[model samples]
Target: MAERQDLTCDVAVIGAGTAGISAERAARKAGARTLLIDPWFRGTLCANTGCMPSKLLIAAAHAAHAVRHAPVFGVNPGSLAIDGQAVMARVREERDRFVAFTKETFDDLPEGTAVTGRARFEGPGQLVLEDGRRIASRAIVIATGSEAMIPPPFRDLGPRVLTTETLFEIPDLPERLAVIGGGPIGLEMAQAMGRLGVRVTLFDNSTTLAKARCAAVHDALKEAVSRDLTLRLGCETSAEAVDGGIRIDWTGDDPGRAVFSHVLVATGRPPNLKGLDLDRSGLALDDHGTPVFDRQTMQCGDSAVFIAGDADADVPLLHEASTEGAIAGRNAAAFPDVAPSERNTAFTLTFTDPPVASVGASPEDGTICGRSDYGNQGRARTEARAEGVMSVYADADGRLTGADLCCPGAEHLSHLLAWAIESGATAPQILSMPFYHPTLEEGMKAALREICGKTSQPVPESRDFGNLPGG
Candidate 1:
């Protein structure tokens, strides 16, 4: 029998997904000899099946939808025939290109810096490969990412059921799709499929869509999406196999029995920590079986091991994952010495027709600084998308703190609010900024001005401020 080989590195990063890649790069840049290990080279779930592919599908769907509605703009386009197969093919092709790009980036790393194998922890600061090779490292980073959580009841459905992990690989779009969650992924796919001419029914046990913290935003989203698909919210549901497809029975405000060619489960995603043998590493797990680690440093239980990205099970967005990965990598490379870093203010977005976005803290009973109902906004009326709301929250002192937007340009608006809140910009300060006429941003300006009027603080006079030559 062949003897087991041994390797050594200053830092070992498990999983080559987005977080893993960021961690590895950070470690190497911090002067640590880094080794990255993964079972495949297709990059993270986002590249393979999640963000990229879904966006491609959504873009195509949006194109079809636009052409169908172009008559409103006095530009009458001819008949639109959506070739589902062609759309799927384009999505797959673009998805492969992204995957190849990520793989190439990994391949260009210093030779011998990466290994392709399944790795598991043998003990503290030690890893065992499938081929009997052992690796020793001063510190380790776990960025294994996550997978679609298939509930126990749906395990036996075979190919008839789909999740984000496997949804993009299908050859053709199902004629009837039953989306089993109302979260970001579920809503995105449900609306996209419906736009592409698929019969879609969306089910959610929760009473609200996207779990919007604001009641107005929730109502606007539910009303807007109902125009596309049959939304069954606040439902108790069960499923069973039928000859041609699966039958779903539900009890809700607008529920009944129906059959779908395919069922998509987008309930949630848990950490992917199946075989890493974390118990041997001296790290503790929470009641939910997720590793307990310091959110700021990504360090776990005074050990050299750190956790980040989807494995952390706190923030799952791509941007948050990359940020967490950098923190984990830098701290792991520095070991006994920790680097001081503060997480960015909270920001998240969901891409629907009228996108949903939240920034900084959730709006509570704080003073309402600004508000805009898109239904009356001129820009929205021009774009024929005038059907949502924008709200800004501030403390009693009139400093911007948070916002919730369900409007035509919520994505961009959210970023603006997040930056203002992070920088301690006051309501009057935001209102003092220039807002061009006949634009969607005018709505934001209106909201800001409203809040400024309500604030007890005196508004700064524009004439007293320095004026540029253009002004």
Candidate 2:
């Protein structure tokens, strides 16, 4: 390591989050010298905000919810108690532990591997740091990730408005929560908070819940979630700071006004592209200022520049980000002779009680559909959790393409279907695999049977494979 203000490297990566770290490691493994830079190297957004902390809150809420519903199963569980302080305390402490693990990655880096500053693109292969240091590299990888957006309406309300980045830091649960936006973040946070005894109203301009494209999934999820929170879907909303809290007014099918202690804006997380001076990079950018790039190679217009993760805004999951990073890093190490990486079957999950999920390709015209309604399902009815739908899609050739699921075990079922689709399995092939008796997975099997009946050939008939709709 030298004390030179101007440093040279084979690859320079910006923002040491999930994508950046993976890219740096991949570049190094490809026999290229790499340097990683960020203003604060304090782990990824998942460890700090998005995934882990939200799950901590959801876990607490689900525990409370289970206790309240114990009487339905004839369990004599006593009155439930939700200690807000203790709940948030455990969340923050456990979150810090996970963050500590991520921070250790930086500690393990060899000398001069990481730089502590934000970077601006000077050209295709050059960067200038905030402290006036210059970095010359053969290739540059942009893995800056993203930030939670605050829309115009919620901007001036100050501390009462919370995004994922600031939600976990709240001292206590809100007296009344106005969750704006019905995307995955909104649904999970609103339902979790409501179940934990907060008065929650989930608002969205569209009637869709969890952004479900399939009408069956949308209806089932909406009906189930309405049990916990007030849903004000398809409404135009406005807000302002009142004397003690925030006042929100809505106009639509039902016009109304209400005051809430706080608002959780879960609209979406747009890519973080500000302050990069990307115009200086001389790469073509879209109307949104995002650089034009190939998703398979993660390259920016055949130049020595690559983008991955939320910076590219293709697939925002951590695993997808890691994949993109590996692709970008390997290609950056061998610029102009880069190879394309194969992508995985896509899936996204929203952790509601009966989770909402979509896996693989979306259904289109001419696609055959198969359905399993969980309302009368054997395992669902036996567990008293029967209240959703699963819609599976297939090609005209009988091969599985995708599925939309809103059911008790949608997350697990989504994984199974994603694997089936990735393997290019037909519905009949998946049905040949054993499905256990009286389990949520049996519900998935039922759906495959429906697909079997619709496809070119049916899955071999099993004698009452648990339960059919009329069985």
User: Which runs of model 1 end up more than 4 angstroms from their true locations?
Assistant: 1-4, 365-369, 459-471
Q: Which candidate is the best by lDDT?
A: 2
Worst window of 10 by summed lDDT in candidate 2: 462-471
Instruction: Give lDDT: candidate 2, residue 374.
Output: 87
lDDT of 2 by residue, 1-471 (tens): 766578789989998989999999999999999999999999998899988999999999989998898899999698887888888889999999999999999988878999998899877667998778899899999999999998999997889999998889998888899999999989999999999999999999988888787998989999888999999999999999998788999988889999999999999888898989999999999988999999999999989999999899788899899999999999999987899988998889999989999987776646788888888777778778888999999887678989999998888989988989999999887777776776787777666767777765756666446444422
- Estimate TM-scores for all models: 0.95, 0.97
- Backbone clashes in candidate 2 total 0
Judged by lDDT against the true structure, how good is candidate 1?
0.86
